[model samples]
Target: MAGLTAAAPVGQPQMLTVVLEGLRSHKGQILVCVTRSADHFPDCTKDPDKRHFAVPVKNGPIPLGTVAPGDYAIAIVHDENGNGKLDTFMGIPREGVGFSRNPVLRFGAPSFGSASFSVAGAPVEQAIRLKYFL
Candidate 1:
């Protein structure tokens, strides 16, 4: 009888692919903010403990790969005007934006916990619906 080798440990690192959809327009950019450190909401200011990727959008999902397994939040801004930043007017975003899990977005961006989710030993998929206001 042949004996099988032991399998790898269950806690191996994995990637979490996030898909941003329903973009109002494809003329802008897409920024993905991911981290295991949750010291602050939208904690993009400090150097991310893991990975961060910003992709110019022409349309459709932008894949961010090889992300470690842990808590993470995905924030995306559809800068329709190509301003290189989220344009806001009177405390409201002038461009389309999105968050992971599609949490109930209020007058402004949602808190880190509201948009956070866990990735375990295997890859995960998520789709965020873009929010827009004229």
Candidate 2:
């Protein structure tokens, strides 16, 4: 038998790939935030342990890197203004917003449970569709 490494190296976290969709235009930057705490679900600002990434806006897959095995929720913002933050008007998001599981966006951001997913020994993928409101 051709024997090789059976699994990932010790201390190596599981990989996560985020497939992005529904970007209004190719401008500004994309912000990806991952959190394990429900309290910091969509906002993620209060969670010091949250994983955040900023990439140029484009139509493609976003590699969010490795994470420990656990339940997690992701929030992504299409910052059209490149302000490094999601803009809003009267609590309404002026830029594009998205969640891990592509949950329905009502009057406000969805709860953590609505977009939660699990990462185990294997790789994980989450597809999110950005939503926009003027």
Candidate 3:
């Protein structure tokens, strides 16, 4: 018998890919948060699995590989100043920001349900269009 080798097959980590477009500029870091809870929809301070990507001031797509397969909502902010925080002017955002499903921003951020998407065992790709107010 040839070399009988038995190795446990490694399973792929469940993850969600976010394709960000309309970046407008290429001079900041993109802060992406995947949340399974509505209580912390946009603010990812409570989420320990937030993914941050440094993108050019140009438009591109970002993939997040740290998320598990489950229902989750996504929020992204382009910190042009690299301050690691979303800048707002008079209760309005001054930088590029967007959410999953590309929900229209009315008075405030979209609800968790409005920006939520289901992720099964397969890899999921979410396309979000970044919007800037400045």
Candidate 1 on 1-134: residue-level lDDT in tens? Answer: 47955433457766567777787666757766776655644536575474555688755546677665578887777777766677888878888778888999877778878888888766667898888876
Per-residue lDDT over 1-134 for candidate 3, one digit per residue giving the tens place of the 0 to 100 score: 69965432234446567778887777877877778888888886776655544544445445677565567888989898989888999989999899999999888899999999876546667889888987
Provide the lowest-lDDT 10-residue window in model 1: 1-10
lDDT of each residue in 1-134, candidate 2, tens digit only: 58754666545689898888877798999998999999888878789999987898877677888899889999999999899999999999899999988888888888999899988767788889889998
**TM-score per model over all chains:** 0.81, 0.88, 0.80
Supply candidate 2's per-residue lDDT for 24.
78
Model 3 lowest lDDT segment of ten = 5-14
Ranking by TM-score: 2, 1, 3
Error at 118, model 2, angstroms: 0.3
Alpha carbon lDDT at 52, candidate 3: 43
Model 1 residue 7 lDDT score = 37
Q: Whose lDDT is higher: candidate 1's or candidate 3's?
A: 3
Higher-ranked by lDDT: 1 or 2: 2
